[model samples]
Target: MYIGRAVIAGYTNEKKVFLGYILASMSFPKRRARIDEESIKIEPLKTADYNNPYITYNCMKKVEKDKAVVSNGIHTDVIANKLDSGYSGRDAIAISLFAMDYEKDEYNTPRIAACFDNRSLYIGIIEKEKIIIDKVRNDRCMLISTYNKTVPEEISIKRSTAKDIAKELCMLDYEHIICSAVVCRREENDFEFATEEKNRL
Candidate 1:
């Protein structure tokens, strides 16, 4: 299935918090994930495509030690800013998704996001026809995507390390895998991060 872009938030069997983002694009597959000390950005390999709004974005942001935000668009930074400004994970995700609505692109692509802290996890989607925000169970992995898998669904993630988790997400049966980024809690306010690109597989 081509689930476009996806976000996963949950806890590993060891009870470590983890968040991940996957870009599965058929239209813009020439993209790669760039991870820094603070965030994960998806960018086009070709400089000429840098200005294309839909293809370049900060897909995940670390707001604080224990708080992080993940999304398919600019809303990732928006939600992270909201958290930095004192909103809870659920509220930040809900407000940002509501304000951004869906991407105003040719497909009217829905904006999907996830925000999680040490205590809670929230996933949201804003589509042209409706908006849904869900508080997910932290004991298990939950996934939300911009295309067909817009609703949050539980998925098993047995991998406990950030690098393995990223590869696991990229290796999912989803078609046209572009790239993936993942973060796993390491200590109070610290996380281990990794990224995987399908072209290297």
Candidate 2:
């Protein structure tokens, strides 16, 4: 799976606030053998590193810094702790990206699950004791690292919402995969399980 970070608008006590989230993509494993669609299964990801301060605070600030936004009023350490415990161990995060073919409430409150067209990013967290980014290609995704501030900027982020970022990144990744396909292989199998893993260098 590809590992990265992002900011998502979260609600607390009905108050809207921008919260930082560490995002990852979870897909089918490459090393596994495939059977009939119905019989195929994969292991559910387990995580114990939810309280990772480095990911919670640093990931959020990295995205904000890309937009030239100051990381004020953000408790890099405290919020990190919250994310650790708040994690439901859920894989797919259903985020609203586009408008759906549905109506809004009378008060114009948008329904999260129904009224909005959404895209989901699947992910999992590795051991919190150590975060290692490897450069390798697997059936799941390729891990990519962001440029270090102590060094130079390798990847740049444009100002956009999490939904926008997800959609565009998905598209960017799709395009690259399509362009790199071999014609002979294309005819042999349907291209369905494909993804990119972004990581920190």
What are the per-residue Cα lDDT tens digits for candidate 1 across 1-201?
889999998889988888899999877777899997789998888744544687888988888778888899998999999998989888898889888889898999999988875578888889999888888775888998888888889999999999999989888999999889997887778887899987777
Q: Please give each candidate's TM-score.
A: 0.95, 0.20
Sequence-dependent TM-score of model 1: 0.95
Q: Residues 45-120, candidate 2, lDDT per residue (tens digit)?
A: 2543243222211222211111101011123222223233332212111111121211232322111110000111
Best by lDDT: 1
Candidate 2: stretches off by over 4 Å: 1-79, 82-153, 174-201
Q: List the residue pairs that clash in candidate 2.
A: 2-197, 26-122, 50-84, 144-199, 145-199, 145-200, 145-201
Which model scores highest in TM-score? 1
Worst 10 residues of 1 by lDDT: 46-55
Compared with the true structure, model 2 gives a TM-score of 0.20
Collision pairs in model 1: 65-189
- What's model 2's overall lDDT? 0.20
The per-prediction CA RMSD against the true structure, in angstroms, equals 1.3, 19.6
Q: Model 1, 195: alpha-carbon shift in Å? A: 0.1
